[model samples]
Target: MWTTTPHIAALSVPTTDPSNTKCYTTKHLITGNRTSTQSEQQLPTYSNASQRSILLATARVIIFNPDNGLQATLNALIDQGSEATIVSEHVVQSLHLTRTSIAGVGQGLSLADPQYYRPKRVDLIIGVDLMAQIILPGIKVGAPNEPIAQNTQLGWILSGRTQPPREATHVVCHQAVLDTESLLKQFCEVESVPERRLNTAEDVWCETFFQQTHKRQPTGRYMVRLPLKTIFDPSMTLGKSHQIALNRYLQLERRLTKTPEAWQRYSDGIKEYFKLNQLAPATTSERQSTTVSDSQHHCSSCVLPHHAVYKEESLSTKLRIVFDASANTSNGRSLNDILCVGPTLQNDMSAVILNWRQYRYAFTADIQRMYRCIDVHPEDSEYQRI
Candidate 1:
């Protein structure tokens, strides 16, 4: 086997042509004291400490060279901006070099600097001029062994210039949470209605809500139930059936006198009349012979004899007469000024005379306090109060 030996030599300065000078130039020396070699050795060019630091710290820098031209400068800027140094076709052509696979032709001008040397593992590249234009001042850069420079550049480009740092807050209140809690407490503290009333109220509220929400008016009539006991009574004046008929007649009279149009429609197809019938009263011998069954049936019966005195006119004729009487009583008078007539002979005579002109000739005597003239017990006059 052949033996290998190292060569060593003194450092020497590199030579430069004066005609190629474009910017400031510097001389560098290279030394190989560790190894011995017969061939000439290459030396590293010396750079200014301040200048090197400036270049390293600069996020963006512009360079102009006579020999390299603007295209080369643009390429160099793009290479500095990008993670990987790129060589363009135009750059190679300007430098009088042949096209190589290592270089790629990219569309649109980029900020990558072609002069900046980058490792093969780098995935992205950009230019210093582009970075200076895009990146905000708030971002941190140049950390040792940090891979976030690319991320920082991206953030700066998207977010624009960063703002100055804000002072820290000493105290803070959870206003949103406090407000939410207050509202919830108020809602929980509200009293709830009983289930039955709640359901009714909810139905009414929903009906109202629908009406208001849809801008529709409510429609339908309200009905009220009247007690028959409040109108008719068991008294000596008339039979129960007669009292019932009279009560109905008075009710119709009130309705027609108060609201003629509404009453007219209500009574349009109805009929009214009086019928007479006869029955025998229970005698003492009959009562003594009456069994418990007969007593059970007759206990609530009246003692008066039921006799057929007169068969009144047809229901249609009675209604017509009643309507005519109401009209006559209401003539030349407003609804508010009209007086109510009771079921008395004097009132009935007046109504009959007012209704029939032929009856005006009968008994032309004027009596004061005609209603007061009739003696009525305090309890019996309750029905007439209305």
Candidate 2:
């Protein structure tokens, strides 16, 4: 038999025998504008095919108010089938909920995997939209009887079939239907034309900086200075990063020990950097020099730290060395914070594709080591130090 929970706004499937008198909860939920045609018809009925229980994916999460920093812990159900994450009304009543402008940027309250929504009794179903943003590429598999563990930004989630309770009798049949209306709406939004906007003051400054400082070498390669703000001196603001880099390197070494192939690739990539003159060893004077005016703490010129980002699907490079330009310094400001982000230089993908069809022959290619090809000016090389 099929029944609806008015409060949760989800369809629940029950056993065929009424005497069983037991029901199991599931993460799959459908919520959106239901068409009149769909609403008018009687809800379709479903029955358990067999008396077998299925395991549902679930995790414990903590929710917090971004404004006051108030925290609450709750149980959450991870549902890849659902379109949107949902919270019970009870959660809103308990905490001061406010709408945030940042969406898909991981700044919104619901986007945080570590802490999400809902109460103890009610489960917060985390849908595909938010799940895709916070998920990291890490997974662990164990023996047949053991639950598989999947690593996420929130933490490790253990999920798989477990032994059912002795008293449990009713079996569960799961079904997650895609909302046609929501899919159609998303399709329309993707096809819609984006509005053009003017560049901000910072963008204008970045443009001016590029035009004034950029140079071309005899080999036809372009060199540019880092777009640093005039207000703060980087040498003074940035703290010593030797210890931080050492700790990160040690952790990476431990992880790489398990995968010799990955370790070899990482070593080869670093060697290429030095061979191309993109990286070099610090001079004796450069290493010893640590002078800052009006600063109690010793600040280093080379304060950048980096980590390895593994992408098995990448065709060219599997392991990428991503420098942490956004790492906070002693004053809580970062290299990214002091730099001006320029306006996007490329046209929209829609415009590019539209023009592509006009050509007699269409060819697709991507630049190899695109960023590494460009050189930083000698004066600004210190800021680019890793």
Candidate 3:
């Protein structure tokens, strides 16, 4: 039969007699969206003309040792007729379960033959020994002392894995209990990568630091700066992403420059953005525009290429300029060609969602022109000059 548990979808096949049962659980890795009607056509079916099946029980058990405070969830294939509980190799490493080796893989073992195992890719076979650690709830069930026959078909799933000759281990199943209250503990935390923080004082420093520069220095006007070139050594080639961005920018520029209506809207957006942030030097005249090489930044006075993405659902102009700071130079150095001796920071979505779940009524707040408003150091401005 077919049915689903909280964590898995499973099918149970009953033999000629209904008293004994065998169950197998499988989880799909499908992404995107589809309806049941569409999925029914794509789902695989057994070819042996197997007898009709019924869904059976599945155990989503969380195993742990209370004394040492170790815990993890195990989605097991519940086979009552099978002699003992088996654990997959991934479980041992992922959940840190303890195990011991008893036998080596051989011709008689599951997925042991190179010809069969190569195609099947069977890495770990959980034997009866792991029954010692299969933490079940209060349900009591009979355990058979039957030994697994050689050359039996077996399958297993892990979070994810790669590399052949799968590494596996067998944990001792102490006892299967109905619940984990006495043995397992649960906890959660957020892991955000470190990122650059804006210097609060530097936010307003330009109006404060007005030295008479050798050139382009007007006493009263605030100095606009070019952001510093990122010092980075790219270990990877741009592949097709750079070309895609370049094409996108070219398309955006072509439409904006040729279509007066499109150009008017785009220019209007730029004007408003510049007016609000006071960042535009002089409403970029044709004289200020510079041509850049498609392959690299060869323009004597390069302006960072720009691009836009449209949101059809929105009425406001979603037009935005892309700052290709990572574009490679003739020497193969992009803005980020150097390394920052610091930890990176990024928000942890899981933790954010967890914290958000605790509240009811909520609202989102955003800063307008957040990145454009940040000021860079004066000495490093030449590198960012367009």
Scored by lDDT, the top model is 2
Candidate 2 lDDT, tens digit per residue, 25-139?
1111111111034322121111123533233455677888898777777666676777777765556667767643333421112212233211124436688988977688888
Native-to-model Cα distance after best TM-score fit, residue 86 in candidate 3, in Å: 73
Please give the TM-score that candidate 3 achieves against the real structure: 0.31
Which portions of model 3 miss their true places by more than 4 Å? 1-252, 257-259, 273-302, 315-317, 339-342
Question: Residue 266 error for model 2, in Å?
Answer: 1.0
Clashes of 3: 30
Residue-by-residue lDDT tens digits, candidate 1, 301-350: 11111111111364332232211111111012211111111112223444
Query: Could you tally the backbone clashes for each prediction?
Result: 31, 1, 30
Q: What does the lDDT read for residue 343 in candidate 1?
A: 19
TM-scores for candidates 1 onward, in order: 0.13, 0.47, 0.31
**How big is the positional error of residue 114 in model 2, measured in Å on the Cα after superposition?**
41
Off by over 4 Å in 1: 1-98, 101-181, 189-386
Stretches of candidate 2 exceeding 4 Å from the true structure: 1-192, 231-236, 284-300, 357-361
- Comparing 1 and 2 by lDDT, which wins? 2
Per residue, candidate 3 scores C-alpha lDDT tens digits across 111-148 of 21222222222223344455334433343232232112
Candidate 3 at 178: error in angstroms? 24
